[model samples]
Target: MTDPIYAIPDIHGQDALLDEALERVARDGGPQATIVFLGDLVDRGPDSRAVIERLMQGQAEGRPWRVLRGNHDQMLLDFLDRSVIHSPRVASGLSWLNPRLGGAETLASYGVTAPDPEAAHAEARAAVPQAHRDWLARLPLWHEAGPLLFVHAGLRPGVALDRQDPDDLMWIRAGFLDHAEPHPWLVVHGHTALDHPAHFGTRIDLDGGAGFGRPLWPAVFEGRGCWLLTDSGREPLTPAE
Candidate 1:
């Protein structure tokens, strides 16, 4: 059997689901199996702070886990460090704290509340621990292991890996998602959530919209094939032709 590398994607602040997914991973792959987190670890749910702390604690315990930065994660950092409410990467002036984006829920996870936007910023700054900010800032945009290349969002097709824009890695959708050609590596990502994991010939998207109250399923890759890791066992994922 090929050695398995597990991946969890777009956690989006659902600590309960995160816990269940981690347990499933451990049950299937043992304690030392390499796990890649494809970003979006915050917002859209009720417990972003707990989610961050759990990942941090796992890494500190010396687990072979790689965490990538997602657009939501970046938005949180921007709000805390620069007071940037709206992201230029997104259109329609969609601020991070917009109800749809779920930034308010993240702030609540940190026990932060304020009377106004200005006060919110200051309160968030004081409430969020410096270590979390440091960890979020240090997360890489992508990770490569053998034939697998992991990212938060899909990459821009035709751009070389080194030349890919950071924003595109975390926020892009159009070209990357619609592209029919295979990427440099079998790109594993989670940004565009589907009712289930999507297996295009070139990429596998593991985001099952845990933030939207759907299930958060972890997937494992071995060579070019994939499977959804569940409590019972592995469920094979066939690529779309």
Candidate 2:
């Protein structure tokens, strides 16, 4: 039998939940199975630093996994850079490290106290280890396997994959979420919060609002369909019958 591809949606600094979800994946797919992390690894929840450390350790130990970048992750990097003031698109006017966007929580996870935004940014840049920053910098925006496309966010409709803007890939919502047209390949994405996984025929949204006190939904895909890899067992996912 072919090994299934497992996807873990937005973690949002919840290391404990992430550990639980990963344990479920291991039980179902074993050590050799392919795993993809659909980004937003930091911000909002506690222990964002530890979350990145765990993933980095996995990569070091030779785990077959891919970590895609989300808007939140990009925000953290932009905040650290010092050269960049604001996010290019969706979060344009907002400072990349604005506390309102969960930057304070993430910075605190790395041992930087956010008494003031500017001061916190400097402290965070100094506190975060270079290795962690390198890993974050190298995270890819997308990954493809068979007919599926794994991304942090949905793709814009009618745009070819190569021509799709990086801004859309990291920050788009309305146009990408509302469109019903089939994509070139089935897209698996996170970023948008949902009470449960939303499985459109052409895409699957695995963001279960883990950042908002919901469960982290990890799933496995084989052929053209998917199943939620829950603590109990595998539950098939399909959009309303």
Candidate 3:
């Protein structure tokens, strides 16, 4: 039999909640289980640095973990790169560093406190560890497990997986969300915020608005089914039914 897979949704800098979720996974799936973090590890809440640090430690310890890159995660990378800010893909004058997008909070998590965006960007760049930045930059946009395709966001319907745009993989919404047809694989994602995990048979959305004051929804997938890991134990996820 295959080892159980734990699917953790967007953390959004809530390290305490992440701790609880991982503990629950360990209790239920044991220490040898595979854990896949569905991205959005930084921004919004407090302690994004703590979240990243913990994951880095886990990686260093050689734990069974896979980290995907979320749009917010890419935004941080873009901010650090600087050149991307002027690209046409981004809004003409919008700054990813704006608090509305949670970049400021991420910077704050790294001990950067500045009166302006420019100062904050410089401090954040200087404060963030090279290792952490390197890890974040190297994160894969998606991970495949048998029939399941795990990504930070939904995939564009009808497009070949290899040909799918990287931006769409991390940031697409309406086009991917509204599609009713099934893809070649079960797309497990965490980008669009929902009150609970929205399991649509063909696709499963694990983003439970944890970045906006909701509980993080960590799940387990085995064979052809999935279950939500709670304090009480595993509850079969049937959001579509």
Candidate 4:
């Protein structure tokens, strides 16, 4: 009697959006659904801190949930998640791309501000919460859900499924997205949001860009059968009973 697992997609700091989807999962799951987040928990939105807090709160309550790292999280991790840019050059000429990745808004969440847009990103990165840095750095790239292997992104072409590296597991999205070849595991992923959920002959795409009002979706696997759970106001791929 294995309880069904609900595979979540990349969040990108939209807490309100995520809550809508989670409420749906709670209603459908009945305390048995294990929520496995596919990473990219922060960036491109204003609620990165709130997102992590809510996720941690749920985890503390024994509501089965697992968090993985996404590329945005990796960027902060590589930069030490606390390193900031202090150069004057970036102030007026070179604007930082932090907002697109949700970093700028998050910085403001902590009462932190930059001398310039770029400096704001830098100072905030340098001041990222310590607890968050460790959590992001320690996250593994993927998870094994019974017969499925969940990655933040997807596997590289020509690489064996079991031998995929953590970096690729967390960041490889280009080739994997273009790859039409069949995969061994039902590699559930969320990094590369497509025009819609792609149904490759051998793989299932559930990303569908949750942060863009698409909703943080969770895939419900019924043995070999699969379906989706989202709050995007669209009918699910199947009726979620």
Candidate 5:
């Protein structure tokens, strides 16, 4: 029998929720299970640092955890490395540190203050350790396992998986979300922030809007089927019959 694969989506700095989700995974899948985090590990919650650090420690301790890069994670990197006010793929004037995306909350997790937003760049650089930055930068854009492809966001329709743009992988919403056709693999992804994990016939969106006070639901995949790894137990997930 194939080992079950576990996936968590869009933590968004809710470390407590993350802990609960992981505990459930461990209970169901045990300590040796492989977990794929669907990105947006930072921003919008109270403890981005705690979330990142926990994941980092787990990976360092030889846990089979795969982390993907989210658009918001890219925003923090852009600010620290390029001093950009916002992500180039995003709107012209939208700063990452803006209250909406919760970059300020992320910075606060590192003990850096974003009083003026612009002026907090140097402080953020100093306060956030280089190891953490390196880990974030090194996060892969996607992870493919068997017939499932785990990515931060849905892929662009009609584009070959290898040919898909990195920006589209992390930030896309338009064509990818609306497209009804099935791709080569089951695109398991987050970033859309739905109220619940939605399993379209062609794909599964596991992002339960943990960034917006929703639960950080983890999912288990076995062969072609999926289930919600809730506190009570595994609940089979599928498109409406």
Candidate 6:
């Protein structure tokens, strides 16, 4: 079989599910497979710590794995890199949603917890080690392979692939999939969750939304085509205190 590109979506601290998906992808696509993660590895899952550790291990081993930061990923990294967020939206909506989705579970994995919600959020913010912060900061906005353009979010329609802003690649929807204007490449991404992974013209969205209690989507790319190999099962995170 041709060495294929396997792209995984969401994650949401579902380390066991991630392992299962990875195993399935490895079995179906072989060890030579190139893997790209669509981000959101932490929050609202049982094993965020394990997931981060495994990803680091894979990278250290030179495995063909790359990651595109999701909105959640960017926020988490920012919670680490920045001392405080000036935007109240981030301090509130983003903060609460993250734990509600699985950020707390990720913290639990590290054998740490805050005395209170405020403390917890701060702790999570401080938990990101500098090394990890640097790594996250340096992640690419998009990864290109032949006809596929992989990003955390789809590039805005009418914007040439070469002209996509890095921030937009990580967070855009209406502007990205305007659909009125034709796009330059077949955009593959995982930010806007779907009831199912579907293709709309040159775009394929694979964020089946693991944090929303759905499957962890893994797409196998071969011969210019993509197919999802998912664990469409439930994996609950610990209930909040």
Clashing pairs in 6: 43-102, 43-103, 44-101, 44-102, 44-103, 156-176
Error in Å for residue 34 of model 5: 0.5
Q: What is candidate 3's lDDT per residue for 89-147, written digit by digit as tens?
A: 44545565655567778888888878576777677778998888899999999999998
Off by over 4 Å in 1: none
Candidate 4: list runs displaced more than 4 Å.
81-96, 115-127, 158-163, 230-241
In terms of lDDT, the poorest run of 10 residues in model 5 is 85-94
**TM-score, one value per model:** 0.97, 0.93, 0.94, 0.81, 0.96, 0.82
Residues 138-229 of candidate 4: C-alpha lDDT, one tens digit per residue? 77787787677778888786777667776777767567877866666677787777656665645667777766656566667654456676
Q: On TM-score, who's better, 1 or 6?
A: 1
- Tell me the lDDT of candidate 5: 0.91
The predictions' CA RMSDs to the true structure, in order, are: 1.2, 1.8, 2.0, 5.1, 1.3, 6.6
- In model 3, which residue pairs have backbone atoms overlapping below 3 Å? none
Global CA lDDT computed for model 1:
0.91
Candidates arranged by lDDT, highest first = 1, 5, 2, 3, 6, 4
Mark the regions of model 2 whose C-alpha exceeds 4 Å error after superposition: 83-100
How do the residues 1-241 of candidate 6 rate in per-residue lDDT, one tens digit apiece?
5667888988878887888888878877777578999877777777777787788888888898997777666766654555332324342445533455455566687665764655665776567566666776777778888777888877767667678776678777766666644455567788888887776766778888787778776778774577767454222212123
Query: Compared with the true structure, what per-residue lDDT tens digits does model 1 show for residues 22-46?
Result: 8899898898989999999999899
Distance (Å) between predicted and true CA of 161, model 5? Answer: 2.3
List runs of model 3 lying over 4 Å from the truth. Answer: 83-94
Give me the displacement of residue 66 in model 4, in angstroms: 1.3
